[model samples]
Target chain A: MEEEVVSEENVTPVDEAEGADQEVEVTEEDARLAEIAELNNRLLRVQADYDNFRRRSREEKEAAAKYRSQNVIEALLPVIDNFERALLVKPEAEEAKSLLQGMEMVYRQFQDTLKSEGVEVIETVGQPFDPHLHQAVMQVEEEGFESNQIVEELQKGYKLKDRVLRPSMVKVNA
Target chain B: MEEEVVSEENVTPVDEAEGADQEVEVTEEDARLAEIAELNNRLLRVQADYDNFRRRSREEKEAAAKYRSQNVIEALLPVIDNFERALLVKPEAEEAKSLLQGMEMVYRQFQDTLKSEGVEVIETVGQPFDPHLHQAVMQVEEEGFESNQIVEELQKGYKLKDRVLRPSMVKVNA
Candidate 1:
């Protein structure tokens, strides 16, 4: 467009070649119309490109934020298990009584916070085994349920949004 | 183009009558070439549109995955803080000792996992204050450092890739 653009020098050079010529001046209307059309086309393309770029950037940011926790959350799962185990213990001694109470509060808060944050626990026990969410480690023939039903979850599944962050290790009834 | 596209049959009867008198025999070659050209043009546009659509879908998926953790990680920050505090505790008693050790191991692994996943701790101390990474709450005139330099970080900043998740709160040297 820069090379093709009409300049004052280009017009003068061409006009001078036809010496002593009667030149009809281009009208303001024609120039205005040409300019308007060019502007209109450019504006539309610009708007479209901006829209696409906005959409792309937004998606990239979201994807980055989502999976960033994949590694850390999985690493913390063991800690969560330990917390659960400690909380499960009955406070028999005088020293453990206060310690147990504090731990319980921390564990409860952690669970509540994870729940609110879209860290959903995939329910596997007593439900049909799904390959998407469950990994069959051991199969058992159980009564009152379908053959592929989930008998018990050995390790719980976790999800970040619709994507499975971690699949549950389960005992299937198959 | 068929009847639905060209509507050639709807042409005036007079035009057809005029054409019937013409001795010029239009060969099938010209018609086939024209059709091929038209199809090629359509194919090009379709391919371009398909590329655009594919790019859009890919970007959307990436963005969805990225942002899925935004709320989740923010919610888990409190739990992380609790772990950090628990690590700082010196174990003087035997009660809950094993649990503490296990939690410590889990916490270390969690930190390592976050590092691997592009979740970075924004460097805050002993550097020139950058408005992008550091938020200055109070200014202090330090002997060794120049003006607008960070003296201390109040809270660590966090980032994922090039994007800043949280700005570090800092005390700046006057």
Candidate 2:
């Protein structure tokens, strides 16, 4: 800010010297016209810069929103590994019943976290299949389900808000 | 852009009308000074706006970088829940053996996902305890380990590129 004031002062002395000399030949209207033109040019440049800045910032904000969960997902991977280890061990003794209970609690916590962030499972079975949410893997003649209805889910599908993250793999009733 | 041009023309006509009438009463020098003052005022306002725009854009960029991982974290919570579900079920028979193996495979995939994103575990036991990476839950006297060295990790800690998301809970040798 101080530097701006200093530069302004530097410009003033030279302008005054020019004015004293030019005042003889140059009319006041001509001088005002020149000053207005210069000011208008500067104004246009600054306005252009402001517009570009606003556009770039908006793009950056969108990218940030799109990828916000990358780190947290990475951190929770080990929690999944721990769950697999506990499951593979096959809780042999009655004493280790608490181990299973603890895992269930953690699992619930994980689900709650996802739900709070608008991540949800795509409903497949018994519902009318939509290509946006479900991918048909096979067609089966199921007795109870209607035609074009999903009879079985081969792999789970997930969505983040309205956007499908992974389409549900399913078998459609013939 | 057309609106801007029209507005500029409107301003010019009014200024010219006023100048023609005031020309007899106001000296040419006074008119030049007034025009210079108006131009100076506009130039100052534009420069101030440019400064503010630059500062605002920089803050937006910082905010975007901070929240980049939020969505990915939300998406993986369900995967963690699936691991917990697989672990909770007691594998009572040989039929469940393949189920356990499938869970293990998913768990490995989760680990690989995290590793690809630069997430890593903070090593605690046998290493010198640093408050930045390890949160000491207890202190114990140990024969082999040096003072302030971690003896056991109660819960693992994780880091995402030098930034600790969760500190390791551990016991340090007194």
Candidate 3:
């Protein structure tokens, strides 16, 4: 009787083990799926980060190509000013006068080229003055103009692709 | 007999159903894990793309800022040429000479300012001919100089931060 009972308990447990192993595979599968889900989330984030990096690099290269001439252009402004002033002078000699005219033509052509390349002169004289790209050198009272109106342009301002390279010096009317 | 068989099948089927349910659950769990893994992969790729975009924008912004003034400087080359020519000329009247002198001073100051901002003049006269920054308009046979030497700089070249704005027009000697 004692042996039979022991055998019964052992056999029952063995039988139950095989059945449970076959049935409970669902829980093991669930655990594996959970692990895979976690891994998948991590991989997705890493790939996204890599994409962002590639996009950023392409944009950077384009920007490098776009603004390659800024410093040189700024340096040339004074030369333009000189040419303009030179043209304004009325030279006595025909040769000097012709030279001045030629210089003026060249200056205009140069201005046109720069305009084509996105360099622009800021018009401030006789316009409502703003501190953003115009510097006030002196203020005076004017009968017809509103306060803070630019009466005279002391110096011209310039912009390179919407960025102010230099501020225009101006006299404002109050 | 028919009732007995039906009852036996029912009794046997309970165990079978439990085992099948568990096995099916495991398969479902695996499928879920696979789905999660796929999602994670997509997420990672998208995230990487975003990161690349961000990086490119940043680089582009930097490059734009770096090369913004090239056009303006190129436009002003003729004006600079005019000033340099004026400096070479001897004025007749005292007032006229003084005015030219003042203009010269201003031009020098302007050039100095440009130098401070990274504008450089390409020195070519008396130097060996370099096609990189010098354009040979005419070649002259000379006794004192070797072949391919620059004798005179017709038009000066200017550079900003290692970029050539214009090639200098030069007289090459053979």
Candidate scoring better on TM-score of 1 and 2 = 2
* Residues B1-174 of candidate 3: C-alpha lDDT, one tens digit per residue: 000001122223347786576456435644564575577667766766666767767776665665555555556566667657756756566545655665566568667867776679999978999888899999999878888999888878888778888888999997
Error of 2 at A36 (Å): 1.3
lDDT of 1: 0.64
What's the TM-score of chain B for every model shown? 0.65, 0.59, 0.79
**Model 1 misplacement above 4 A:** A1-75, A85-103, A117-174, B1-20, B23-38, B56-71, B86-102
Residue A66 in model 3: lDDT: 61
RMSD of each: 14.7, 10.9, 10.1
* Cα lDDT of model 3 by residue, A44-121, tens digit: 667666666667666766665565556666766777787577556776765555445554555567688778777888
TM-score of each: 0.54, 0.61, 0.61
**Best candidate (score: DockQ):** 2
Better of 1 and 3 by lDDT: 3
Candidate 2 lDDT: 0.65
lDDT per residue (tens digit) for residues B27-51 in model 2: 5456556767887887788788878
lDDT per residue for candidate 1 within B136-162, as digits (tens), equals 999998888888889888877787667
Candidate 1 positional error at A96, Å: 7.1
Alpha carbon deviation, residue A33, candidate 1 (Å): 40
| Residue A95, candidate 1: alpha-carbon lDDT | 54
> How high a TM-score does candidate 1 get?
0.54
DockQ of each: 0.10, 0.18, 0.17
Badly placed stretches (over 4 Å) of model 2 are A1-28, A41-45, A48-52, A55-63, A70-106, A139-147, B1-63, B70-105
Per-residue C-alpha lDDT of model 1 across residues A1-174, encoded as one tens digit per residue: 011222232233434732421121123324434544565555556557656866876776667665665655666676676566556666455555555565566677787887665568898988888899999999898898788998887887888667787889999987
